[model samples]
Target: MNIYIITGTSSGIGGAIARHLVDAREGVITISRRENIPLSRIAKTNSSFFRHYAFDLTQTGKIPELMEYIFTSFKEVKLNGIALVNNAGTIDPIGPSGKLDVSGIEAHLKTNLVAPAILINEFIRLSRPLKVSKSILNISSGAAHKPYAGWSNYCASKAGLDMLTQSIAMEQSAEEYPVRIISLAPGIVETSMQQKIRATSAEQFPMQKKFADLYKNQGLSQPDTVASGIIPIIFSDKPESGTFSDLRYL
Candidate 1:
């Protein structure tokens, strides 16, 4: 069985990835702040293969507990492949560095940076005993590579995440059983995050017009389309770890 644990699946890119996995006949487990209506329906229809956990990601302390539950619950089953996707992220509090709220920046830092790193570490430790192939997908952003005006928090958090992935990839490079970890930047998908960008004032988010133009000109990529394309990469042998890849470049 190809088992997957994914975060921020209530909607947007994360939700699409979970749906894609299910469609491919892979086992899926979703963790989100709120219960996903569509996923709950899937669970009812495919009870044996689907699971959902409605918990807050900002509560980073609960991550280990959540991972332990998954490990214990599926202990007896022989696994063919295991995947952990740290896809949950926030792009709000859009403004210049001095104008943005410190509280909001703190929240963004925790959700985007801290949570994924912890999950990646815990997954490596737990999967050490399993013989199955393992992979981790860090849903990254273009902000990781280039800075955007009025997006100090978002840019800094993503850059930090990219570095974290790079460091861990090297550490596990020569392990007896290596886990492939890739930080993927899925590029301009049409999701709630885009909507938030479109709604922001030009002064607060200088690039607001660019985002609005994308929406108006039908330039946004569909979340499901991108999800379908990226999910297959996890099962492929290409793209060595510690690499930052973009779907557009793929």
Candidate 2:
């Protein structure tokens, strides 16, 4: 049986991914800040092979304990552990770079960068020891590759994450771990995060027009489309490590 782990299953792409996995009868272990309400709906629709783990990933210290529990609970049938989706993220008030709060930056770093690294570390350690092939799929952003105003902290964190994924993939080649790491820019999707961006004030958000124009003209990819393309890659034997792809590119 293939086992999958996912973060931010509370909503948006995370929830959509979980639902897609269910429809395919792929087993998944989902983690999120709150109980996954949409996952429950998915459970009602397709009940087998899904488990929910509600926890705040921002508390980086708790990750070790969580990993221990997962390993211990699933030791018997763990060979098929396939992918870890680092999908959890946050983008608070958009503002001028100088006006951003220190705490807000730190919060984004922890959730967007540090926590994912921690999870990747634990998953690799567990995978090697347990002898399972695995992959780490990090949901990065276009901001990581292209600069956008009023999103300094988010951009920085994502850029760092993008590099981290590349570095990990390179390291995997050298070390030959039975795992691959991919950093994907999921492009713009219609999510609550977009709603937050649209609500920012003009004074604080100078580049709001760029975002508005993107959404208005380009529209947004449905979460299911991304999930469909990504899920196959997660299970593929092709060398996806160190590659950065977007929905359009896929």
Candidate 3:
């Protein structure tokens, strides 16, 4: 059986992705602030292929233990293959860098950059020895490759995540037990993050109107649709490692 460990499944793209994985009969462990109820229902109605862990991703200090527990309990099931999707993220401190508060940036960094790095490290350590297909997909953003007026902290954090993906991939390429890794930009989906972006003040976010217009024009992709589109790439044999790409382009 295929196993998928994903974060931030309480809502939006993460939640949608979890649902798809579970529906596809893959055992899924969801890490989020709250349990994903729809997925929990699937666990009951389907084949008990779902596990939920409730914890705040900002509490970075506890991630090592959490990851340790997951690997230990599930390591025996490592024969088939396993995948980790670092999908939890934030769009906070959406304003001018000069006016940003320290706490907001720190929180954003902890959630977006630091948490993923720690998780990736632990993931590699645990899965390296297992003789099975292993993959790590970092849910990157378009901001990582672009400069937005009011997303300094968000952009920088994502850019850092992309770099982390690159560095880890490089080390794994020459190793005996390598893990497939990708920093994937999922594109703009109709999620709460878009609402937050559209609700920003025009003075702080000059392009707020553009986001609003995207919603108005029904241009945003559905979360479930995007989630479905991404699974094949994550599960397929076409990729090895050091893949930094956007889902739309793929």
Candidate 4:
């Protein structure tokens, strides 16, 4: 049996990916901060191989133990672990550079960069003996490459995520570790996150109108559309390891 882990399953790309994976009838373990009440039952309709963990990814200190628990829990099963999607990320503390919230920066680093690396570390250690193909897909953003005024913290975190993905890829390639890493950016998708930012006061969020106009005119892609492109890349034979990719390429 093949196993995969995906973080963030409440909504947006995370939920879309979960549904897609379930429909594909593959064994999956999904993580989210809130309970996906419908998902447990929905997943069973097409696939019996599904599990979920509702926990905060920001708590990096507890992750190693959690990974150990998962390793031990699944020890009895024969497994080929393919992918770990670091889809749980956030863009917060949005403000000018000088007035940026340090707490938000810490939160961004923990969720976007630190936790993913720690999870990868633990998974690699635990799965060393398992004879399976391995891959990691990190959900980054165009914000990482482009400059967004008042988005300094978000940009830095995702930029760090991109770098981290590259570093991991290089390390794995050097060691011939079976794992491959790809950092992907899902551009301008319509989701609740966008809504929240758009709802904020204009004075507090100056970019809201520009973003709203962009979405209104450009027609933002749906989460499902992004997921469709992501699914193929995860299993693609093309060599995109240690690289950043835009969904339009697929």
Candidate 5:
């Protein structure tokens, strides 16, 4: 059986992806700061196939131990494939770089870059001997390529994440069993993150009105729709490692 581990599964695209996997009878393990009630209830009936862990990804020091525990728990299961979806991210400190708080900037980097880096490192080390397909999908954004007035922190972190994915893919290509990795931009979706963006002051985010208008005009993609597009890429071998993709183009 194939197993997938997804972060930020408490809501939005991560939650939708987890739900879809569970529906397809795939083994799914989710991590989030809080429990996803719907997924928890469903796991009650499919205990062996679904698992959840309430985890704060910002605590980077504890990730190695957490990964060890997760891998050990599934040691007995014969697996065909295993994947990691780095979907947990933060878009705080949304303002001009000069006005952004240092603490908030640190927190943003920790969640969007540091935590995923550590998770990918540990995942590779632990899964090295598994003799199964291994993949990593990083949920990136257009902000990584385009700069926004108030999204300095978000853009920098995502850019770092995309480069990290590319570097790791290159290193793994020479290995006997390489892990496939991709950084995908999911496009604008109707998520809590978007809500936060829409609520930002126009003085801070000059483009706030653009996002607000997108919502007003019902132009935002639904989480379920984005998840449906991403799920196939996660399980398929269509995209080459180290490449970048956008859901709108696919």
Candidate 6:
């Protein structure tokens, strides 16, 4: 049985992916701060293997215990493969560097960078002895490579995530069952995050008009579309580990 563990499945890309997996009858475990009502409804109708954890990633201290509980709960089932999608992220503190809130900046880094790093560490440690195929897909962004006027925290966190993916891949290469890892930029998806970006004032985010125009022209990709494109990549072995690519180009 192929199993997938995904973060931030309350909505958007994560929600889309979880729904797809449920429809396909694949084993799925989702983590988010709130329950996904639509996903819960679909899972009930499909009778698929599905579980949801209402946990906040910012509580970084409890991640290992959470991961342990998840893995232990699945000990009775035979698993052919397991994958983790580090898709939870935040783009807050969207203003000039000097004007950003100290607490918001801390929360942003915890969600975007530190949480994923700790989760990956636990996943690798717990699944290392198992011979099953293991993989990690980090939902990165184009902002990681470019510096926007007001996304300093977001940019820094994503860039650090990419490097973390690369460094882990290098370290795991020699393991008997090394995890395949990739950091992918999913392009501009039409999610609530985009709405937040569009709503930001020009004084805070100079690129607000650019995103607004994207929405006005219907230039943004839908959540399901991006999910469809990356689902195959997530399950396939075609891409080398530590690779970073944008969905638009892929």
lDDT (CA) per prediction = 0.87, 0.80, 0.87, 0.80, 0.91, 0.93
TM-score of each predicted structure versus truth? 0.97, 0.92, 0.96, 0.92, 0.98, 0.98
Question: For residues 93-181, could you state the per-residue lDDT of candidate 3 as single tens digits?
Answer: 89998899899989999999999999998989888778778889999988998999999888999999999988888998887767888
lDDT of 4 by residue, 1-250 (tens): 6666889888899888877888777777888898666777888777557878878998999999988876676676677656788899877777777776778778878988899889989887877777777888889888889887777777888898899888877788765446788888888888877877777666657788977886779768999989888877785655478999888765
Those runs of model 3 whose alpha carbons end farther than 4 Å from true positions after fitting are none
Cα-based lDDT at residue 123, candidate 1? 96
Ranking by TM-score: 6, 5, 1, 3, 4, 2
Off by over 4 Å in 5: none
Best by TM-score: 6
Tens digits of per-residue lDDT for model 6, 35-71: 9998998998988888899999999999999999888
* Candidate 2 off by > 4 Å: 44-47
lDDT string, candidate 5, 1-250, tens digits:
8899999999999999999888777888999999899887876676647878888998999999999988877787889999999999988989998898888988899999999999999999999998899999999999989998889989999999999999999999998888999999999999999999999999889999999999999999999999999999986776789988898998
lDDT of 4 at 56: 93
Report the CA-based lDDT of candidate 2 relative to the real structure: 0.80
- If both were scored by TM-score, which would come out higher, candidate 2 or candidate 4? 4
Instruction: Give the candidates in order of lDDT, highest first.
Output: 6, 5, 3, 1, 4, 2
Ten-residue stretch with the least lDDT total in model 1: 39-48
- Output the TM-score of candidate 6: 0.98
TM-score of 2: 0.92
lDDT of 3 at 172: 88
Residue-wise C-alpha lDDT for candidate 2, range 124-150, written one tens digit per residue? 887776556778889999889877678
Cα deviation of 163, candidate 2, in Å:
1.0
What TM-score number comes out for model 3? 0.96
TM-score for candidate 5: 0.98
For model 5, state the Cα shift of residue 83 in Å. Answer: 0.2
